[model samples]
Target: MDCTNSKSVLKKLSVALIMFMFLTLTQGYQISFADSVALTNSNTVTVEAHFTTEKIRDGFYTSLVVNYNILDRSNIKPGDKIIIKLPDVCRDIKPIYKTEHFSNCTVNGDTVTLTFGPNINEGVQGYFTLYMYGNSNIKNNQNYEATVTIGNKVVKANIEGVAVDGGDSYPDMYKVFGTNFPVNNLGEGIIVDRNKPVPYTIVVNRGRKNLGTMNLKDTIPNGMALDTSSLKIYEVSPNNNYTDVTNLYLNSGRVNMNYKHLQIYFDPGNMYMVDYNTFVTSTESKYNNTATMTDYYGNVQGQAVAILGSGAGAINVYKTVDKKNIGNFGNQNIIYHIKFDSFGTFLKGTMHIQDKINPKLTDIKVTGTNQFTVKYDSATKTLDAVNDKSTIEPGDNAEITINASMKNVKPGETITNTAQVNGGDTNTVHTTKNPLIQLSKVGIDNPNHLLSGAEFEVINADNNERVSNIVTEKGNTNILITSDKPIKFELPYGNYKLVEIKAPNGYALNTKPIDFSVNANSTIINLTAKDNPTGNIKIIKTNDLKEPLQGAKFNLVKDGKVIKTGETDKEGILEFNNIEVGDYKIVEVSAPKGYEISKDTSVKVNKDQTSLVNIVDKNILGNLNITKIGNDGAKLSGAEFTVEGPNGYKQVVTTDKAGVATLNNIPWGTYTVRETKAPIGYE
Candidate 1:
């Protein structure tokens, strides 16, 4: 057995001896024990008193040794008082009493009060010695308890030691033990040894002279169940130990559940033994089992108590997201927790736990206790936590945390992941779908017209802030739109504007920002912009008769420059198309075959507006020559002619020597010629 187990055994023996002696003597006596039994005396000191009698000539030298042990030396000061009220047995026997390490001690009735001085260590000890009458007829197998008072603390003195009384020392008692529940009951609480098998055993002393059938009854502790098939019996031969007699028991199947207890019957002459394994099923830390033994006729033999350690050696995991259920379109943080608990046992072995990280998570970072080493593998997407010295004591837990990020999740898609611990349990979490926005570029004039090479930017019109990198949004990567293709964005719920940043060549830039919302799933928006107008101008060239004239050239001028040059067609129309809205001047560069050049005409062109200007040209003049002869027509000299206009205005012309006269300027109209004077007229 280990040192801890040895201490536990010694403590049990001491308690049994003291209790048996006290109870055996006071069984028929009318004695008043202490009314109340408190667990602790004071925060600074714990007092224990033990009584032992030495054989003397006329009486027994009963010594009541009160050991004052300081639990916290720093908390005690001088002048502290300790009062110990002895059992009724010391009432008439306290003849001579003395103490050590006490400033003063006084006896009053059955109580002794001692005042403390300075110089007290945590391991300090003090004793009180006294004498008792030999004829008192003290009984064996009895325990005498006292009441101890320290400062303002009051408690019962539970100090117990093995008391022989006189005889009755039997060395053939059976022992029951929990192999896995190793503890030093004398020092403090239960101390568990996790490396041992989880089993309970009953062992009988070897070389027994004569033994009868032994009956044992044990109740299973909470959170533990006995494995019926694991029950095994053994018979020791004094020479060869651990001989298996498990098959000899015809009633091995009788170890079934009997109100959460186990009972066994065995003949004790051959040093019989029985053991079974217990399975732990709960998280409770401590387990206690009490076993009682009896002879065939039901005569009480001995009782043994077993307090086992259970509950530890477990791992648990939990996962949480920063965005809760909604998984944003982009990168989001996911947090995980890993916990290891030793339960009611001490874990001192190499422990390793691995978690398969979901492929959707990346950039994993683990932070926790320095005792564990954590590593992540990208190929397998797993995180392994291992340690060589995982010293986790009972009732304590070690936890580690991991933080990771998940990226590029789409809208209406959930990102779910599961985290598991090795030889333990698993937990899962997922995200919900968020809203999305779809934007398309369009022409205002034609809804079906796909406008290419138009770039747009989406911004929060409320604050004029550009939205990007939203955690749950479908990643805010580059949003450069092109080629009339519709652009989709998973954005946070808000009001936004789509502004045209750049437009195609020969197209007007839409300076207006289109406002929309992304409050619901699949929110659709289309931005419309109109192209600048390409207007036209028409010029008609005609004579005074207001008819169409051909072969007329005209220059269309805008802003003092010739924008286009065109001649009138067969219909006498000079037309200019696909021109911007502005003031223009149309000048006739050349006239038709029989018309003069028309003057410049000013006109203003607007969007989808047609302007028409009419230019009238007058006909040119002609010269005529005539000769007056006697009987034949000859070249005339000094001939005069009159040209009449349509408005009744006349012009006179005279023919010169060569019988030629020219009319320099004349209007195109109906005219009549009259010979006013003829030199040598022949007609």
Candidate 2:
């Protein structure tokens, strides 16, 4: 047969067999003490047939039958016994064989034994059904076996089943009922709100046979209410198609609502089904729900459970600076606000707020919210906010305001503070005020043409030490002054010095520092720098012998350079004009006839200043020759004469064989001669 026809035939056979079994198992059984029977399938065994548990509750008496097909087996025995064995799943056991083929069954704790009767037919094909009281649910999937013995061979048939509704639930193909949002599927923790109803889609998948007339019931936990209008049911086809059946389902007064319970009926045959929507509200802190689907046979088919809880509220702490700018250093005000926003949920816990104040500030004074207990740590400069009352219910917004101060701050400096809410989120606020310093550099001669490219250094006026890293331009440690632009600095208000470290090309450096104070207001200092004017210098070359040396050469050296070279005139004077004002050296390069050059002399020229360099070049004199005569005027070779001159001059002369002695290159002054040693007879 084709697959389609084969499936259709199998389905028809399965339905017929399910109906027959359902009638046989549930027809005569009546639970007298209980209102209804909670019969769940205990075991199923068949040959060349499919079996399933359908419409049966747990912990109920059920019937199990073993069918034997004896067409092929012909042992040809009339007195042989057929024994049947039962598992531990059944209690209060009894056996029934209508054909008189088996009888006299007895049960042990976990074993059941059966014996064959004498009326057993030679060949038979039928069922031997066992009646037993049901126990509590099984722990897990377990096996139940029935056996028959023939000579030395044993034949057994087995059925596997599981416990249900007795502390055990496992994934099984026979069971149904699930949800779109399971607690495990929704992740850990119950994070939901009742005022805001959450949706959970309940689904009932297809089973082996048609489950007739199922009643869906929901038991809501305390502090919760369900929305009746949101009840919806959808018939899901085999192709996963949805057809809304809520109108038809609820039209027959199928809904039965109690205080916290709901029951609705749905006739879901062998097809997928679903309750599309339902909403619930929780009035308390948490909510729990359990829903079940049961058939008309009083058998639970599917179940779903969930738990949800309202989350905690959020905390926000905002801080702001009161003053736009802090003009002075001490005692500035800052405001803070702590808000506990419910965010549509209730909160009950301790609220914490801590503020780490700027170390530059001190003496924290709580100006607002005197109900809060304030603590300060001077070492860390922290302020803690602790409320006396800690509990906050749902929809409760508790707010606290605080005002504090900052100290020891200066102009052009920023003071910042931060505050945290619930020891988590933090916010920082700051205030700053700057002091200005303006420096104007100008030439003394021309104030309008201010000094450009004149670098000035800033120093501490108290110690006269240079300050670093404060500059108006890159690559410069000092502030450069321009003709039209004055140098300015934003600094903390205090005492500082502006000193001209490098002057313009020709201007003189101002060595004196401009001492100034930066107070609340801005200050401007107009510094004046001067450039030296040209001056004249005259060099007078006079001989010590009271004569002017006309041919004397003079060199005027300025900064180690010969600036002017000139010879003295007839008056023994040389003059240079328009010489820059600075230190200059004048030297006689050459001397006149019979005159010696003088030493170099240094002179400093000031603005429009004239200075004279009186260099005296002495005139060289010729040697005086003297003769020591004997009686024959013979040369006195051994004569020594010492010549003494004016102005602390002295010399010595010797005589050769011609008896001559002379003194050379002496000054033109009167002198006396004396012979310390005389020749043989001359003195």
Candidate 3:
């Protein structure tokens, strides 16, 4: 009989046996079938067959054992064949038998044939194992049968299906899951974002079966679209080791995809993983996807499911200014606060922010962003910020602050600033300019009296340069504020000083400069400058001649008190500089040598002019000699006399033995002499 025809007949018999067993069970009768069968030859060959594992899973490898024995050796011969035909669900059979009994073993489909060698002996009892895989065509949760023929003898064995529903065995031949955007194995599901991508993995041939020419179809769920460019394939071993095979499989046209599904075709001799990404396209709350793996015959080998839930909500952005009004000058800070709020979902990856500021603003700085780093571009007057490591969960808010300066901006001009978050939400803030300075001038001696005709210059203290563009109420830079009118002007925010360039008539010029600062918070400033009334005094000294004296010391007395002291120059002029306007006396404290001191000369000092006083100091007269005799030209000693001279001068002198009493260094005036004591016998 033809061996190929025998395999067909054996399959029919196995099906009949199953049907008969079913009928017998229904009729309440029990019958037992032998595991061994006798051959139709004189040698009395017997064959028995069974599976090593009682239960086998579909799409997995299992071992089928067949044993044969020759009771009598009379009919043993070389070239004899033993054929084993497995059920259609079983494929890729590999035979393992002793070489002494079989010359070679060959397989066709699910059938294994063994040829006997010349060493065949009587009573030969050896078992051969056939390693095979149960294809997807097999019915699940039932017994699978196979037939064996040894020298025209046939035997059959049953393999029970694994109880997959009871969780006794691994069910699916493939597994699918998501990570990155929605991490796998997390107790709580990850929230999805439209800007984020979700990575998916489909593990095909998970049982490590040699399933030839299979296809995997992964259905993309609603609210998402497949990313074909991100698809990759990896060959995975049973030990969990991975080898990248993306380029090899993709270049060979084995992987393909569309907007809705991704398909991969491969000969899975080992386990393989298909990785790809999907972009969220909708605001749907949940997303579910399924991956199905099928063999060459279009039968589903296994299926797996993956789910992604929750989606991001709209983002809100707001901005505000710390100060609504600021000075136009430099050195003033303008703070802007920006906030971002997430209504729902989790936001990850880099968050970006951009702010465009007014051109007049300078020294831009960013702060208060704990999760972000910021940079500023002066040329563009913009701030760029990014956060790479932080995440924003549902109902969370993030804040950032920006600081800048207002410089060279015109008063009353408004500044507008706008900011955007993540290239989406935008917000704006505004600041107006308000700056002024008021100056009033008064007399230092009389603070209550406001002086006029005072000229002032505005200077920048930072650079020591004269400032321009000053807007005063009088439309001039002169700070000549008086009792009736005060000077008011506008200046940029910065450090500055006021200089008294010119003083009012009759008032002394002030040389000291007053320092001040202009800023945002203090926009208006009030100032007061003081001056003193001043005058000069001139004195002329001579010795009874119309000539100016050189060495004459004088004291300027006010209210009988010495206020100032000075010496005359070659012109005999001693000026009491910048004297207050009041009544005073110019007294000659000491005259030039050989001249008498002048009397206290009454004078007055006035504003903006000099007062002149002339004094004539007569030259010293010849020494005066007096003699007191006893009425007879005789010399008298110890005679006391009183001498009186000009300018209320009086002195007492005693005569010497020569009867001479002298008066020296006296002014030109009439004198009176009177005897106060006489000699011993004279009166």
Candidate 4:
């Protein structure tokens, strides 16, 4: 009985040990599962983000929706939280305090923490609408991505279709959003002329959201001044149509202007449009204007920005010659006037003016008002002037005078001088003296018939010296005067003679010097040099016996075109008078009754000389006869033969009843005759 008791005790102790071991293993497994829950929580949750609007303007507020789902509730506990890291460009975040799934929501810098509620369940889904302001650092027209942390797992969410800087929005107008609608938004700015008003348009409540007691404020750019008289307001409809409500707003004192700042109050009704004008007061290149909308409590709702650009003002420089300063040969003491007019903006600081004086001008002197300091560099022929202290106001004019003497300049010679302000806006002026001469070379009897390729030398009659530096119209030493235009050149005020060095083709050269005079009284002197044409073609036709052969047809060809056609007279002589002097060809079209045509003769006619062409023709004739006979000397009547001659000439002949074949009118050359067909039977 004691042994049985010991066995029973041992079994009980073994059972007890087994239970303790099972408990230890179960506890260890529970602890391991609890530790792994944090790591596996990442796979139990899903996150996604997207922008509510298709595109959000850069540096503006936009709505971002972040959706999260709890896939496995066993891994997620009441105290667990999901942390969403917002993008860097998202600033001024306005997050919801609480949602259905999360009991508390808090933001710390760029992170948003959402704590799970006590009643968290499996497959629970919720979303947070975050109103984030995209800062200027955000790249335009690009998708944004953020990271979400759930336990030890990190998930990525992307907000696509978001753009900055008015991408896919109105041009130059950055549109910002409020909780429900758009607030103060201005259109793109434009450049206007100085003192001219620039128009501006602002649209409010474009989303048609109704909010009570809305207040709008606009701050004009520093360089612009508001025009109160041009302010107008209109009520807008959902379809984007407008109704003028300026009078009602003005009478009710809803619109107020405080210098460059403007304010308007509207009772919630419909969207509104505001129109106004501002004049640019400064010469700044760019101006940025901002407008904001707020509730009655002064909580800012939305903001918009408009940019203005003032185009560079035009600075015009005009240079003119003083008409009173004149001389016989050229302007001995020429005076030039340069005027500067500032069109749209004031010229400040040192306004530089440079005048490129003509090389022919000497002794340069420039004078201006007390504001200007002038200097002249004779070596470079440049005059420089500067306005250092005084400012040239817009639409105001500044003048400077330049005095110089002309050297080595002939009469009718024009000197062009150019001046510029600030190395741009170049202006030019020209001065000329009197007594211009235009020499024309024409036909002797017809003044309208001009000639070309005539060379001449001008000599000073008093000094008997050849004149140099003669300026011609074509800038060439050899004058080419055409029928439509005459050659003009400038000479000094004195007596001069033109000696013809070479005349045009077919025109006689005038050896005598053509005398002319240039004086201050006459502005232009027209002279004509007439040339006598030479072209007479005489053709003498004769026979081989050296006797005159009459009735010979001839053609005078020039450049392959027949100029004249005639037949020789009874004396075998043909003459063409008044023909153009050039190389020509005389071709005999047909010879007299019994003679053959002569070969073509080339001849050249000289100026004022007759060209003689003597052509002789031969009256020779050749005949060919063929007789066909049998072997016994009997006549064969039906024989046929082919005759070939010079110049690829060929003919066929047949024997007649007299047994004879003949070929006539063949040129003087060797010939070949072959029997093509024999009489009747003979081959």
Candidate 5:
């Protein structure tokens, strides 16, 4: 509000004074803002410039008196100068600059929009441009919201600033407008509106006598309380109106200027009030994607029962649609309506009707890339390009791919993918399980690139084991699996045991076991031989000392022929089955008694290993003796007796006789007692 001494000699300034003041204050001293950016959307991206910076000049929409900073380090302009540049984008359509923003960084225009790019390959990216002087100067180092040309639309960002604040030395906060008021008068620093309302965030010291303010009025009358929490100033001013103010509470004990501290105008009819009206008419709003906008204002700031007004002075509060998926709750909205018909008259103040119809935070996009974190330049408003690096083991190739899992994914829908590796890779994987790859209008419909698929594979490794059966599924992007022949696998090459699928194209598939092995403990396996033999065949488990196998089977064969089949019982004895009594070979067809694994490679019907073929399995108890003498018989336990058996068999056993003795299975021989122990009964 350049309400300075321009009125110092108000009623009595010489005609010369008026002329000099007008020349110094409103001449061709233009404010130009540019956003110079070097970007690559592969090369560049489009841009859109919205108006929210230190408001542009006073009257002519473009000739803005920017006080707040928009393109610097802190977002608050501390100086009165700025530089902006936009990306050099190419468009199929022409008529480069919008109505006001021509290639020539025009002086005082309301809006400016230019084009940047849609890279030769895809889209675009770039910068903004700004220029200003006076209270609206682009301060030294402050970041401001800016816009650029993108394909057919405008892209925007908080373009960083180049260090241009206090010329020679770099200071944390630069100063351009009001003089720095002393501690005692901290609050006395005149708040001005340089066409562009300067965004001021004061951090006041505690326990200090805070400063006070008096605007467009003469005397500080009695009982006019100046409570930092609430003020009685509205009563003093003629029109009594304030745009904004911070609340009464302290921020971490410090008095923060959170918009709650704004005071109503002392006199709405003041020329500064004229400036305020202009700010209202040219207001540029940012609807936070909701359907309505909310702006809170208070008069009688210190009073409990003050009626609040909206940005355009109308008194209705608007809410957003509660259809939740669209973030209806935390929506920011605004609508501005204005009528300057009676703007300067005290009596017509009531006739200067105004109202706003703006979008709420719910109406604009709050999705897509939500929050951005990056290194940026203070003066240039350019995002610092970051360099990244990585490495992999020998004999490996690294690939990074992006993908879109579905063809036409709905906005906000979750997505998934499937991937694999041909040449083995050892690189650690970054993946998503049923990763909620949410979809947005910009990125949906992209092909599932290799990288995304690989990541999906990494995440689904544990869950995909059970997916089964794809019935006649086919597509370049669709997963598929089929076997020309049964796939076979085994531990030892030919032992074909199992088969499986590593990755599916589109449809999900399950794993299959192709081949398996078993421990065949089969005994008496069939080994048939055709009969061309001339004689019977016999097989044995042991030499002459033992008979045939206790539980063995055999087949007489002549050239692998089975002449006859026979088995041995628990007793080591077997017959010659049925065969010609001639030269013939005996083959063990079944497992033998008490034998783990043994083979009779080839056995002829010849004499056994020890001949005789007499070994039997019957238990034959050794020699026993019977002795008798007269009437008395003796039963001896420890004496040996010799028995004479037919066939010249001789044997011995301890005598045990009571006129009768027993012997077990004495091999069909007749025996007589040749010797007796102790001359039994005194024989």
Candidate 6:
């Protein structure tokens, strides 16, 4: 009786332990996990391919290769038979088929190689398949794994079944043959005792290198034939998102083929535009094609429209040692990239087994010009593409532009922009050298500092007088100096000398030489001046018709007024503006030969408006026959005097373009003529 009681307790304890073990396997992990599996098994496989039982328009199908190291325990060779079963739930998919080849398989004394399908690392039996309608994307659930008998021994393994509808609930490794879906929560290691090193099954790739820019492609290397154009791949890890690196949509089934017929590839889950180039190469001729064949079943060759990398996401990370991508694309038999830049990034998360149901989804962040930077964080294993600082100035406020792929974020998520000034105090200022400004100071300090609360007096350099002209325009300007102090002063707008300084009680003056500049705030007048007749003359109202006109009024004006004025006579002209050293009455006109005048025309006498005068011969005096005073020495040879009526003209007898005719119609009044116009070209 006691023995029976002890046995009952032991049974209870065993059951509880088993139950605890089951619970732990299912619930112990808060995150997803995975590992690379090495395939080196020479197991006989039963390949059964079919479509889902319940088909809408069409049905989908997939296959799996069951791997087992059973040769050591029993006798099973090529062509040997093994019986396996599927759950009654899935009747549509058949139960058995024939095994193809022991791919990458080896009976190296005891260990075998698993080189079947695209995945070559881990032990894989064969690819289970599904059949569906034309151009239809379908999948199946391998319902259950029933007991299978191999050489009189009942072996147990989860049956690779088929289910077309439950993609949302299960992993669909159907895209890549022999590949497993769902982040491989299981880790990788030798299942057998490592101490007893059985012949190594997976060949550690010893060749093929990464070209800085060169990538993995199959066609580059001749002698290799792969099917890349028509393939459907699955996103097994990282939530099975179907996309090439750079977000470019790609056929889920095709992995790129490269040199030596090696299988190299880019990631469907990385920044497609930035980092989607892939390649593969090898040294050994025999292993070259084999390695590629074992990695991916098909080859890739076609136009690549890799979309640009996501702005907010970090560079994609891949499972590459040296240069080869692990498991072709995944563990055992798969092809893909688990890549991202290690620098300037911050986050790490593994997503797996994304299918038509569960796909890869990520939210990326981008920033405005000079707004923020990115960094990596190891503890949080997730990329944090967030703004690190604000790029704004207090006085010159700015708007931060956030360029992110949140377009899918229908309603924008609340985000913050935190800017930081590395080394600065107060408001920022954009100096001459730097266009970007930071807050450093608010406003200027001192505006004006007067002497005893009185306006500063203006001084003229010409006469040292309290002048009004020198101190006009920009009469007063405000001056700000520093932080908390300000002063006022009324000053003029002119160049000044630092004579002295005066300040209020207890406040220090601007000790640095206080030479400041003011602006000219007064309005200025500009005059465009011209005269009807201008010429060289020495005296007013002299020469020509009358030597001196007694009562003619004239004034020289610049801008508005002249500092001097004079009179003209029958010559009907006057002079102004050009005042220079010369004769008593007038001066400054550079006279023609035989005509005495200064270089500058000063008092050119002429009609104020219009006048007339009687002409005399050149050697004759004005109304006085002054030439006869030379004892009749003059002959009037150069000028023979002539007179006309009020309408008849001389010299120029008719009017021309300017409507100015020669002197005519004297009417007994003093007449005028062309003043100092020498014969054309004589000057």
Best by TM-score: 1
- Tell me the tens digit of each residue's lDDT in model 6 across 117-199: 22112111222211112113223432233343444544433323332333443111111112221111011111111111111
lDDT string, candidate 1, 1-683, tens digits: 00111122222211111111122123321122212343344455555443332221123223343434343445666677777776654433342211123445566767766665543321122233333333343344345566667877666542222222457344344444555343222211122222223466766545454657766677777756677777787877777687776665645643434536777676767776677766544323245655666664444433333323221111113445555545444446667666543321222223455777767667878765654777778789777776534444333446567787755445555666554433333445665556555555555445676667777766787898776553313345534454665555565677877777876543456677778776645323344545444467888778777878889888888788998999888888878876666788988888765567777889987757678788888776554333444345566777677767644658777777777666655654456778787766444
> Which has the higher lDDT value, candidate number 3 or candidate number 5?
3
Which of candidates 3 and 4 is the stronger one according to lDDT? 3
Alpha carbon lDDT at 426, candidate 2:
41
Give the per-residue lDDT digits (tens) of candidate 5, residues 493-518. Answer: 11222223332222212233333221
lDDT of 4 by residue, 1-683 (tens): 00011122122211111111112123222222111111234456555444433344455444444444444555667778877787777777665322224556678887887777664532233344455666666665466666667777766545433443334433211223212322211223323123445666676666556556778888887767889988878888788788898889889988889559889987675788787777666544345666777753354533333222121122335677875325443336878887765422222333677888878777888888655778888899888888764545433546789888865566566778766665443445677665567778887746687788877888889999888767664553533333436777776678988888877777767778899987656566888887767688899998776778889998989999998898889999999876766788999998886678899999997656798899999865788898988898888898989999854779999999889999886656678999999888787
Clashes per candidate, residues 3 or more apart or on different chains: 18, 7, 2, 3, 146, 138
Better by lDDT, candidate 5 or 1: 1
Better of 3 and 6 by lDDT: 3
Alpha-carbon TM-score of each model against the true structure? 0.39, 0.31, 0.38, 0.30, 0.22, 0.17
Who is ahead in TM-score, 2 or 6?
2
**Candidate 4: global Cα-lDDT?**
0.62
* Candidate 5, poorest ten consecutive residues by summed lDDT: 306-315
* Native-referenced Cα lDDT, model 2: 0.51
Question: Model 3 over residues 474-547: C-alpha lDDT tens digits?
Answer: 55453434454666677777899899998877787788999998876655587888877888777777656577
Clashing pairs in 3: 329-492, 329-493
What lDDT, from 0 to 1, does candidate 5 have?
A: 0.24
Question: Where is model 1 more than 4 Å wrong at Cα?
Answer: 1-181, 186-196, 204-211, 238-240, 250-261, 297-538, 550-557, 560-570, 574-581, 587-600, 606-610, 617-683
Off by over 4 Å in 5: 1-43, 48-570, 573-683
lDDT of 2 by residue, 136-190 (tens): 5543556555454544445554544455443643321122223323132112112
Return the number of clashes found in candidate 1.
Answer: 18
Poorest 10 consecutive residues of model 4 by lDDT?
Answer: 13-22
Model 2 steric clash total: 7
